[model samples]
Target: MHRLYVEEITETDGLIRLSGQNAHYLTNVLRQREGDNVLLFDSSGQVFDATITDAGAKEVVLKLTLQYRPKEEQSVAIVLCQGLIKGTKMDYVVEKATECGVSEIIPFYSTRCQFTETRKLARWNKIAIEASRQSQRVTVPVIKAPVSFSDLLSMIKNQTDSRSYIFYEKGGTSLKSQVLPDDIKTIYTIVGSEGGFSPQEISEAEATGVTALYLGSRVLRSETASLASVLLLQFMFGDMVYS
Candidate 1:
């Protein structure tokens, strides 16, 4: 079923009035008509089966017929703390991570970060939503604004229950050998930029209880490392649900 993320919806009200871009997309782009059934996902992670009750020139109305509530433990939260690299690498990470079911993406600035601008959250969020829609995910991943390395460590230090790993290009424990924390469902992965994190940055993250892990012998580019970390963690914990 075709799915859309709708903002205004209620359990009591069965009809969803879609206007603006939504109406235009469904009517003109998707060529949806009245009686066409589509799936709707709300911000609260609620899934609803809806039919196009009206696909008028002014608006598109959907009548929700069924609601599916996800299991309380159905999700395994995976947070990606990525160093901002130059070019479109960060954009690729956000889009691919969202497609792979990353719960949140934290774009941070390390000493070697090449991209220092922090004004791309809106664009990244748009990519995340589009990726979620393409992946048939009910919830879109949250893209957080960029923060300094210290600030990133503060956040990571607070996540005592999360399985935290920072991928180091140099010597570090192999990811395949480390045992994932069994008590927690939250996994946090950190990847450095093009030049990678400095020795001090790695030590700071390590002080916050982040395990320095290696992705094998081959060194990966910044974008590839970020995507690979998310894929590996999600594959071990959450991606199977989406698959």
Candidate 2:
């Protein structure tokens, strides 16, 4: 069965209208007809069992038969702060990070960043939405606009009750070796762009109480580091382990 994301699904047992691209997707792309059944989800953490009551060129109507909230969401408060890596690579990182249950994704520009101009967030949000839907998560990770290295540091200084971890390519303590502070509610993981963080930048990050975490011996690409760190953190401190 096809799964669709709708903006607003208000009623548990009433007609819900899907217009514009959604309607085109159903009538033209999926070729769904009346009597077809599909799953519908909304940003409100609600899922609906819907049947196609009517299909037309402009819109489609679904009669929602059942509506229920999903299971409790992943409890981790990991925020992935990545250095801008340009184009599609950044998109891939956002998708993977969302699937891994990151609460937010921040792509910042550092000294070695390929480009500094912030990209529009429409595409990234779509990727997160699809990723969240596929991963069976009710909420999508918040994709933040790109910020400068200094700006990010300032943001770090302002964050109260949160621990910041900057993944340095140079020697630093491994992520697994550090224990999460019991008092903090959020964890920020910062990974560099293609050229990686410069020495002075790393020093400044550490001077401001950010822990420099090194991931083993091999030098991973920027995208790889961002995605891998999220999974590792999720497993160690997040909701990956059911037991």
Candidate 3:
């Protein structure tokens, strides 16, 4: 069954109002009719089986039938602080980041970023939402607007309690060497734009607790690094052990 995220869901009432593009999806694209089953999530960490009761221009009504175990969320809350990139590259980052189990994605502007602030942020959020639904993730990773390099540094300074790591080509240590306690609940990973972070910016980040670590010897694109970090982190601490 297809998955959909709704803002509000009621267990007792057993109904959900699907709106926006999703309505268009069910009505036209999927050609779903009354009694067709689909999965619904409220972003509250639960999955409910629902069937369409009605479909209309603005919204679709779903009747909840069964509720299953809450979808498995990442045990480690990793935030991907990615530098703004051009066009669909950011979209690819958002989609892959969610699938690999990132808790949130922060789109911040760096010195060498190509796109303007308004353009990239707008598109990144939509990509995140769609990816979360497609992956059956209970929570959609929050995609924050693009902030400046200086502003990011200040925010990092304020986040003294959280563990932060930056993927840098010149890094001396491997990201795998960062010892995350079994009980560690959250982590923050930063990946730079195509040109990578400036030396001054890297130093500033270090001052605010963002330790630089190399993914490998070779330089990778921002999207590739973002996905690689998330997957590696998950394998280190998450269910990737089964594989």
Q: On residues 95-172, what C-alpha lDDT tens digit does candidate 2 reach at each position?
A: 888888998888799889978876568899899988987887776778888889888889988998788889887779
Q: Which sections of candidate 3 miss by over 4 Å?
A: 10-12
Model 1 regions more than 4 Å off: 71-75, 239-243
Instruction: For each candidate in the order shown, give its overall lDDT on alpha carbons.
Output: 0.82, 0.85, 0.79
| TM-score, structure 1 vs. true | 0.91
**Could you tell which candidate, 1 or 3, scores higher by lDDT?**
1
TM values, all candidates: 0.91, 0.91, 0.89
After aligning candidate 1 to the native by TM-score, how far in Å is the CA of 20 from where it should be? 1.8
Off by over 4 Å in 2: 11-13
Q: Write the per-residue lDDT of candidate 1 for residues 15-50, one digit (tens) a residue.
A: 878889888988898889999999888666888899
Worst 10 residues of 3 by lDDT: 115-124
**Top lDDT prediction, candidate number:** 2
Q: What value of lDDT does candidate 2 attain over all alpha carbons?
A: 0.85
The weakest ten consecutive residues by lDDT in model 1 span 67-76
Model 2 compared with the native: what TM-score?
0.91
lDDT of 1 at 65: 94
Tell how far residue 179 is off in model 3, in angstroms: 1.1
Show pairs that collide, candidate 1: none
Give the lDDT of residue 239 in candidate 1.
49
